[model samples]
Target: MKNITDYSGKCVLVLGLAKSGYETARLLKKLGAVVTVNDGMDLTGNQDAEELITEGITIVDKEHPLSLLETNELIVKNPGIPYSVPILQEAEKKAIPIITEVELAYQINEGTTIAVTGTNGKTTVTSLIGDMFSHSSKKGLLSGNIGFVASKVAQEAEPEDTMITELSSFQLMGVQSYRPHIAVITNIYSAHLDYHGTQDEYVKAKMNIFKNQQSKDYLVFNDAQRELLELYTVNSKVIYFSTVRPTNGAYIKDDAIYFQEELICRLNQIVLPGKHNLENILASIAVCKLSGINNEAIIATLTSFEGIKHRTQYVTTIDGVKYYNDSKATNTLATKFALDAFNVPVHWLCGGLDRGNGFEDLDDHVKCVERMYIFGQTIPKLIDFAKKHDINYEMCHDVKDAVSKTAKFTKHGQVVLLSPACASWDQYPTYEVRGEDFIQQVKSME
Candidate 1:
């Protein structure tokens, strides 16, 4: 790793002890920084905290004390922690340089970075890029919001390695100089307004992915959002990706996918479905082409990649009814993509933590939804949507309840889709848990 700054004798506070926070603390301590970790949870038996204590890193668990801010020169916060947190707000007033682990990863990373961010398709595009690299001559280290801690991945990455990172707007907001060599924004839409407080703030947060990029660096953007994205003054070279029309980078023309003027693969050869997935594929192609990856590797990866889990992932077919888990659709736009993928009559399982956003945007997209299985905190909002569309509806306690109810009512050739277009915190702790519950429930029917 490149030693960009000397952290010796610097007092740094790591706010929130999640995986990223734990890794960040360890890395800071390793660099001789005076590290103090603060988490609201009581870490009395936490193995991670114990390990850190052994390394002489201070653990300030149980609560986030305001006093810690007075001593620390810098704050490394977990991405999930909002800036509205009192400690963070105070830090801002104190002129502390607050950042997420993504910034720290960039500061010390020896490898080239390819960061992907968007409302929906970033995870798929990031994973596809990494998968493409794995099948090719080059090496790509997959990390960031894709599950692996960015700082942890950066710690082991070599100079020649390509860091394919799936970044969220939450993570991007804290970045200062975290410029990726090849940045991709699959598509942008209004999301996470609960944390950001406004649509514009959320969009601005996602824009941080390419903020520090130079003219030599590449920004692979979704062509559909050209008007909104182009509003920002990007210093980097813009490479457009479109499933609709020809672009400067990757596009579909004459039934085949092309990067610039060179053919990558035929449209019929792609295994992943949906126009959203096509947008994801286009963005991946742009990044691969910018990285100089061979078309063979791209084609091989594209043809075989079924999809990542919990994002319109097919679980199984029971009695001719196909079940799909898309619990990652934590917003209306994401759910729209999930709904758009299926032409067959759908048992649309949705609703969760309402983020105060209505599902009216999904009015035109839910034409194929034969029935609505609603659950969680946003049940009333989803019920209103179902009523407006004159679709049959059922209220359930949670995802498992919804899945079981849908399974009984679903007819042959119909789809049982668990695409909750709201945050899962209303019931399950995470979307992953909700998705796993949906999968297990569907499997039990067999």
Candidate 2:
């Protein structure tokens, strides 16, 4: 693979004018490369793209012209663009190399990268690791498939800096030579199958994080993620983390977090609740141990790390009823964690854009839940499942209506939980937006 420094004076085509795309163009231009930005969205109406155009960067909107590919040294593709796209197919046909924003960022940034990839808990784990490094006096930046893009971090990263990147399967699918010094697979499940077309393909995309790592670099995996263990074969150093104590690597033995080298923390003392967070904590501790961070510092940070919002976040207690905003539970496995964490009579608020999730996994937990209030696009399917299981359920048109109805049905001692096991795109822009909306509705109930 050609290093990014070798691209000086080379013509490059940056496909997709998203933040990452625009940043790639800017970075390439600064490196003395002729950069052209291509996006499917119209620039005449896009304020972001218009601002970039005013800066003298060449912009191609609506459609990508084949001529642009003919003149470029490489294509820095946005992950949102499918590999099956005709333009990309044509680029491949012509033997033009294509890379993702992550690949580009990795090439330019002269620092050790610790990438976190999984079906869930990536953001939480990434943030925790970043916080750990920050407290340890290590210069660290968090970016990637999470809200912060790698381009933003790459712009400021120095040689001694460490980067914690949260990678999605979509972003990983297009990565060429991007390899993290410490790569972590938190866990994997069926997700983004709609884009990948198969579970195997989705897993393969995630596995790419370790594909390019050298033997000296570390690769971390959850012992519980059997699928990942079965499918992955690596030449790099491998470490395992789990809720149960493993003979090697990091694990929970009795109520404590134990590592092959030393004891990390007592699991019982961990402030974060649920078995799912135990896995996340184990992953973070494993990374910190590998980085030579002291056990005391790791424990101190983990104890105070309150966790990210929208993931089982406590909202308010109204008339003795506690409400939790778990609007980030966009899958059955995630919702299962929320249910497992709470022992109270739960007035569960669930349902949204269904991603072909099998509700069968949630059947037993539904019995524990006092009642379910279904909403958004998946209400009918949830209601049908509820009826089949003889579970008490009610459908609401939206989250606001669901919260209002939940308030009426919930007793003073019961917990009103907004753990929607589906995507929020049907009604809200993002999971954070959905969570904020739920908080607003809960506040209005008083």
Candidate 3:
């Protein structure tokens, strides 16, 4: 993607009127692109569409017609629209340059970018990196999959600034020439299989983060993911972060975070619990060091930075029972980490869209869980695990139901954790919405 300032008279189709699509359409139109927006949802009363209509941008809703691609020079796709979508498949046949909103941001992004892609911890790692920039004299913007769209951030950015982007595999897959000065892969897991179809395709899409990177660019990753080097070709300089080995990157040693023999912070200094979170800190350390940030600010940021919202965020204590909202743990692996973070007996609430996932691995983690409340579409599978382990369990219809049911099981000094090991699409559109609902329900108990 080039730094295109003027799209004057350029024909572009912004597919899907999702957050990224709306932002992309607006930016492109402002730049003088002949932009037409398309979405599968009806635009009858959509306030989002109404705003775009005032700009005179054409809107095609309910269906994606092949004729919409006619005379189009570019297709800026919303990452949420799967590759299997008819329009995207048709775009491929016509050789239209298909790209995500982030790709468009890459074109106009004047600032240096740090792109993070992985199954889990991407949000936490990206937010931690943002804190590193914020706590210091350095300036950067956090956007992308973590909530804010990248195009919106890049539009107002200056060359002196940096963009800390949290990218998903879906977002990365449509990238063509989008290269980050610093690329981070938190860790690859077998997730989003329902969308990507296969683990290989998912991994390939994630590896796209390094595709356009030059030799001078830095690639930060888990030392555990050395297979990323073995599995895919990477030309950028590799910087690793780990709790395992202590070389060529930032790592932990003697309970202190280190960047190649340089001490950043002790484990106790970081307010975030869980060893997985320490890995996030390690990634931030490597990024700050590469960006020329000092150790003091890095350690200071680690000391005060509470975790991201929706992912292990603290809600409140009711009747001495502590509640943590980990609604962002959309997979078994992520929920496993959440469970491992708490050492006390738990009244755990989990379940949601199955996505064809297995909970067999979760059986071991349930040892700390005193009772489990299964929720959403995966109740039967989760119930099987509860029965297998002989752990007390019940079922719920949704997040609100789960939260209310746990109230009955809550005990003083016990933990009530909402670490659903499945996606929230079965109940809520996104994890954030699901998390907010969980927090709301928990608060109502008081």
Cα lDDT tens digits, model 2, 281-324, are 88888898898777777877878888788999998999999999
Task: Count backbone clashes in candidate 1.
Answer: 0
Reference-based lDDT, residue 381, model 2:
87
Error of 2 at 101 (Å): 0.9
Candidate 2 stretches greater than 4 Å from native: 1-4, 64-68
lDDT by residue (165-266, candidate 1, tens digit) is: 999999999988788999888887878889999999999988988889999999988888899876799999999988778999999999999988898889
Off by over 4 Å in 3: 1-6
Candidate 2, run of 10 with poorest lDDT = 1-10
Whole-model lDDT, candidate 1? 0.90
Clashing pairs in 1: none
- Model with the higher TM-score, candidate 2 or 3: 3
**TM-score of each candidate structure, all chains considered together:** 0.98, 0.93, 0.97
Whole-model lDDT per candidate: 0.90, 0.84, 0.88
| RMSD each, Å | 1.2, 2.3, 1.5
